[model samples]
Structures are given as structure tokens and as C-alpha cells.
Target chain A: DAGVTQSPTHLIKTRGQHVTLRCSPISGHKSVSWYQQVLGQGPQFIFQYYEKEERGRGNFPDRFSARQFPNYSSELNVNALLLGDSALYLCASSSATKLFFGSGTQLSVL
Target chain B: QKEVEQDPGPLSVPEGAIVSLNCTYSNSAFQYFMWYRQYSRKGPELLMYTYSSGNKEDGRFTAQVDKSSKYISLFIRDSQPSDSATYLCAMMSAGGTSYGKLTFGQGTILTVHP
Candidate 1:
């Protein structure tokens, strides 16, 4: 079976621009979580959605937001991007005991 | 202090050697422990997971947890070059409001020489 998949494997945005990254969960998976990983650092949690509802959120600024669709796919949006927002964004889907991750979207804000 | 702490090692070892990676935590409420391996530019992949404290072994990989000391370890026996990557330690609380929110370590980089 296919694993979690993310789109626009790479992205480059200018400061003050808006960007959206997408993810598709594994079949039958109901939970989708977003993370931001900066160079040389572990992934930091962003948002988590389960059953189309927001289940949890991290310490990110209000400019960062996400939503899960009826199909269990998710989109992460960043508005008024800053250079500090440049990082690789990862998405994960959960099973009973573990989470399956996607290749991630590499976002570079210039 | 960070919730989870791991040495950011670019440790290099020869093939067939035993490799040991470790992490320490400051959160006593964390009940689920996990290890993940991430390659450059890719997402992390789940490796081993344990609940509570004890040791679990699978094939060449073994995971050990010591709740009393808030310590965990992953041991890879007979390491291979393909095993080179970043290893991350993660944990979370169980049966509470923070369940499923994984806190991660800084990750350790391992390189096995052929």
C-alpha cells in the first residue's frame, strides 16, 4: 500500500507571500499531523487534525494554520511568510500505535 | 530544559560493530517511547516503540527504557553502511489531554563505514 504522500516536494516563496502545502494520509487513517523541521533541528509540531476537527496545536504563530478535508487529506497554510519560516514541513498519519510520515515539503522563504 | 535530550553525534563506526544511541527525558508523564530514522531531505520513519519501561528486541535492533532514570537507548548490532542516518527519540503522554503529541529529541547522526 502507498504510504503518506505530500505534494509540491519543494517550494520557494518570498517574504510576505502565502504558501500552502498538501498531504494525503494512508488508507483508512484518520489522524493527520503537521510538523516543521529546521536545518539541524528536530521536527517541531504544528497542527494535528482527527476526523476533520482540530485536535491539537503547537506554539507556532497565528500565521500558520491547517485543515483536514473529508477525505483525510490535509493542507498547511502559512500567511505573510517570513524568512524564519523556511524549513521542511512534514505530515504524518497515525495507525493504532505508530505514525507514518511523508517525504515532506521543503519550503524556502527568500 | 528540553523535554528530550539526545547527543547530536556524527558517530562513525565500522560495519559489523555494535552501535548504541541514547536519549534522556525530563518529562515523567511520558509513557510511550519511540525511535525514528530519517534520511537527508526525507521524513522520519518509525523504528522501535515501547510503552512503560523495559527492553524490547527485534532482529538486530534493541530498545531499552529506564523510567526511573528517564533514560532510553537503542542498540543496533552488526551495523551496516545502509544504517547511516539520523536517529531521533520521541515520547508522549498516554491517556491524557496531550496524548498523541510527540515530543522529540534533537536527533543523533550515525554513519557506518563499509
Candidate 2:
């Protein structure tokens, strides 16, 4: 089966702009999570949704938000973007314990 | 301090050499430890996982977790050039809202030269 898939493999935005990234979880998966990875660093957790409910949130600012749909797809939206926001946004799907990740969307803020 | 600390080693070693990677965590509640391999421009892929405190081996990779010390390790034996990539250590609590939330460490970059 296909693995977790993310849309808009890459994006370029300006400061104060807003951007939305999408993710489609694997079939039969009900959990989706978002993470941000800066250059030369490991990924930082942003938000996690299970069964279409917000299960957990990380130490991100209010500018970052996410939601999961009934079909288990998820969208991560960032408002008033800053140059610091340029990074790879990754989406992962989980069944119970293990998580499978997507290629991620690379966002560049100019 | 970060919840998890790992040596971000741009380690270079010859193929067939043994490789050792480690991470130290501050959260005592973390019960599950995992190691992931990520190539450039790609998301991390789970490599090894261990529960509580013990050692688990799969193929040439072995993972160890020590709850008392809040330390974990991943060892690669007879390493090949294909093993070159960034290695990340992740931890998770047993249940509750933290069940699926993973805390990751700074990735260690490995280069196995042939």
C-alpha cells in the first residue's frame, strides 16, 4: 500500500504571508501528526490528531495550527509566516505504536 | 536543556567498521525508545525500537535502552556505505496524550566510506 503522502512538495512564501500544507495518511490509518525540521536539526513535533480529535500539541506558536479530516487526511496552516519558518514540514501516520512519515514539504520564506 | 540530547556527529568511518550511536534523555517517563534513519531530503524511517529497558537486535542493528540512566543506544555492525545517513533517536511515554507523541534528538550524520 502507498505510504503517507504530502502535497506541494515545495513552497515559497514571504514574511507575513500565510501558507497551507496538506497530508494524506495511509489507508486504514486514523492518526496523523505534523513536525517541523530545521536545517541540520531533528524534527520538532507540532500537532497530533487521532480519530479526528486534537490529541496533543507541542511548543509551537499560535501561528501554527492543524486539523484532521474524517478520511484521516490532515492540513497544517501557518499564519504571518516568518523567515524562521523556512523548513521541512513532515506528516506522519500511525496505527498504534510505530509511525510512518512522508517525504515532507519544503517551505522557504523570503 | 532539550528533553533529548544526542551527539550530532558528522562521523566518518570506513565500510565494515562498527558504529555506535547514543542519546541521553531527561524525561524519566519516556518508556519507549526508537532509532530512525533519514536520507537527505527525505523523512525519517524507523530503524529500531525497544521498550522499557532492554536490548533488541534486528539484522545488523541493535538497540538498547536504560531507564534508570535515561540513556539509549543504537549499534550498527559490519556497516556498509549504504548505511550512511542521519540517525535520529526518539522517545515516547507509555500512554495518555503523549502516547503517540515522540520527542526527538538532534540527528547524528554518518558517512560510511567504501
Candidate 3:
């Protein structure tokens, strides 16, 4: 079976641009969470969504938002991206048990 | 200080050597602890997990938590080149502000030479 999958494995954008990263959870998983991992740092929580609704969010700026679809897929959107936004965007699937993660979407803001 | 603290070691060791990684936390509320391994250009993958205190072992990996001291550790035996990666410690609490929310430590980079 397929594990968590994320789209646009790599993307490059200019500062002030917007970016949307997609994630398809493991076939039957219901919850999806997002994390940002900058170079030389651990992954930081961004948002968590379940049943198409946001269950929790991290301390990220309002510019970072996310939504889960009825099909259990999810998307992370970042508006007015800054150079600091350069990081790996990870998507993890959960179900109150443990989390299984995707390979991650590497985003680079110039 | 950050809720969780870890040594970002570019720790290098020969194959078959033992490896030890650790992290300490400031949030006493954190009860569930975990270790994740991340390879280059990939998401972090769960390596081991523990609750509150004590130890848990799986094959070549061992996870230990000391809630009383707010400290945790992960150990690997017979390490190989494939073991090279970044190790991250994460934790969450059962209630309060950190409930169901994990705070992470700066990851440690490990290299197991073949």
C-alpha cells in the first residue's frame, strides 16, 4: 500500500509569492499534520487537520494556513512567502495512534 | 530556553560502534516522548517512542525517558552506514497547553562510517 505522499517534491519561488503544497495520506488515514524543517533545525509543527477541520495549529504566523479535504488529502498554503520560508514542508498522517510521514515538499523562496 | 534541547552533533563513529543520542526538556508537562530519524531530503521517520518514564527497546534501538529529570535518550547498537541521519527528540503532554502537541529539539546529525 502507498504511504503518505506529497506533491511538487521541489519548488522554487520568489519572495512575496504564494505557495501551495499538497499531501495524500496513507490510503486509510484520517488526520494530516504539517511541519516546517529549516536547515540545521528539527521539524517544527505547523498545523494539524482531521475530518476536514482544523484540530490544532502551531505558532506559525497567520500567513501559514492549511485545509484537509473530504478525501483525506491536505494542502498547506503560505502567502507572501519570505526568504525565511525556505524549508522542507512535511506532511504526516495520523489516527490517534502514531504518525506516518511523507517524503516532504522542499520549498525554496528566493 | 526552548521547550526541548538536544545536542546537534555531527557525531561520527565507525561501523559496528554504539551510538547514543539524548535530549532534555523544560516542559515538565510533556509525557509522551519519541525519537525520529531523518535522512537527507526526507521527512523524519519515527524510530522509538515512550510514555512518561522508563525504557523501551526495539531490536537495535532503545528509548529511555526520565520524566522526573525531564531527560530522554536513544541508543543504537551495531551501527552501520545506513544509520547515518539526523536524530530528533519530540514530546507531548496528556493535558494542558502541550496536550497532543509535540515540541521538538534541534536534531543531531549522526554518521556511521562503513
Candidate 4:
């Protein structure tokens, strides 16, 4: 089975612009989570969605939002991008026991 | 202090040597401990996972967790160049929103020179 997959492998945006990143979870998986990994740091949880309902959210600001589709795919939308927002955005899908992650979308805010 | 503390070591070791990676966590409620390996520009994959304390071994890798000290370690035997990557330690609590959410350490970079 395929692992989690994310789109727009790379993206660049202006400081004040907006960005939307997409992720497709593995087949049969019903939970999806988003995390942000800065250049020299580990991934920080952003949001988690299960059964198309928001299950949990991290300390990120309201500008960062996410939603899960009926098919368990997810999208992370970040607005008012700042230079600090430049990082690799990772998407993970979970089963009962483990999480499968995608290669991630690299977003650069200039 | 961060909930999970890990030395961000660009730890370099010669091949066939033993490598040890460690993390100290502040959360006593965390019951599930996990280690992940991440290659450059890729997402992390689970290396070892254990519940509560005790040690678990797989192949040349061994994961040890000490709940009393709030410390966890990953040991690699006969390290090879392929083992070069960032090793991350993550933990999750037993109940509430934390159940599905994992708190991660900064990660230690390991490079095994051939």
C-alpha cells in the first residue's frame, strides 16, 4: 500500500501572501495530522483530524488551519505568511498503532 | 525547558562502532515512547517503540526507556553509513488529546563514516 503523499513538493511565497498545502492519506486510514519542522528542529504538531472532525490542535496561531476530507485527505492552509513560516510541512496518516508520513511540502516565505 | 530534551549532536562515528542516542523528557505522564529515523529532505519513519519502561531490540538496534529517570536511549551496533540521519525521540501520554498527538525532541544527527 502507498504511504502518505503530499503535493507541491516545493513552494515559494511572499511574506504577506497565503499558501495551501495538500496531503493524501494512505488507503484505509482515517486520521490525518499536520506538523511543521523548522530547519534545525523536530516537527511541531499543527493539527489532527479524524473522521473529518477536528480532533486536536497545537499551539500554532489561528492563521494556520486544516481540514480533512471525507476520503481522509487533508489540506493545511496558512495565511499572512511570515519569514518564520518557512519550513517543511509534514503530513501523517495514522492507523490503530502507527503513523505513516509523507515526504513533506517545503514552503519558503520570502 | 522543553517537554522533550535531546542533544542536537552531529554525532560522527566510524563504521562498525557502536552509537548511542539519548533523550530526556519532562513529562512523567508519557507512557508511549518512540524513536524515528529521518533522512535528508524526507519525513521521519518509526525506528523503535516501547510502552512504559524496559528495553526492546530489533536487529542491531536497541531501545531503552527508564521511566524513573525520564530518559530514553537508542543504541545501534555495527553502525554503517546507511545509518547516517537524524534520530528523533517522541512520546505520547495515555489519555485525552495527547493520546494521538506525539511530542518530539529536536533530534540528534548521526553520521557513520565508512
Candidate 4 local lDDT, A8-35, one digit each (tens): 9999999989999999999999989899
Please give the TM-score that candidate 4 achieves against the real structure.
0.97
Candidate 2: tens digits of C-alpha lDDT, residues A1-110 = 99999999999999999999999999999999999999999999999999999999999999999999989999999999999999999999998888889999999999
Which model, 1 or 2, shows the larger lDDT? Answer: 2
Docking class of 1: medium
CA lDDT, every prediction? 0.92, 0.94, 0.89, 0.93
lDDT for predicted candidate 3 compared with the true structure? 0.89
Q: How many angstroms is residue B67 displaced in model 3 relative to the true structure, after the best TM-score fit?
A: 0.7
Q: How displaced is residue A109 in candidate 2, in Å? A: 0.3
lDDT of 3 at B113: 88
Candidate 3 lDDT over residue span B1-114, tens digit each: 788999998899999999999998998777789999989888889899787799999999999998888889999999989999999998877743233356789999999988
Which residue ranges in model 1 land beyond 4 Å of their true spot?
A: none
Q: What's the true lDDT of residue A96 in model 4?
A: 55
Per-residue lDDT tens digits for candidate 1, residues B47-95, read 9999999999989999999999999999999999999999999998876
Task: After the best TM-score superposition of candidate 1, give how far the Cα of residue A98 lies from its true spot, in angstroms.
Answer: 1.1
| Span of 10 residues, lowest total lDDT, candidate 4 chain B | B92-101
TM-score of chain B of each: 0.97, 0.98, 0.95, 0.98
iRMSD of prediction 3: 2.2
Ranking of all candidate structures by their DockQ, best first: 2, 4, 1, 3
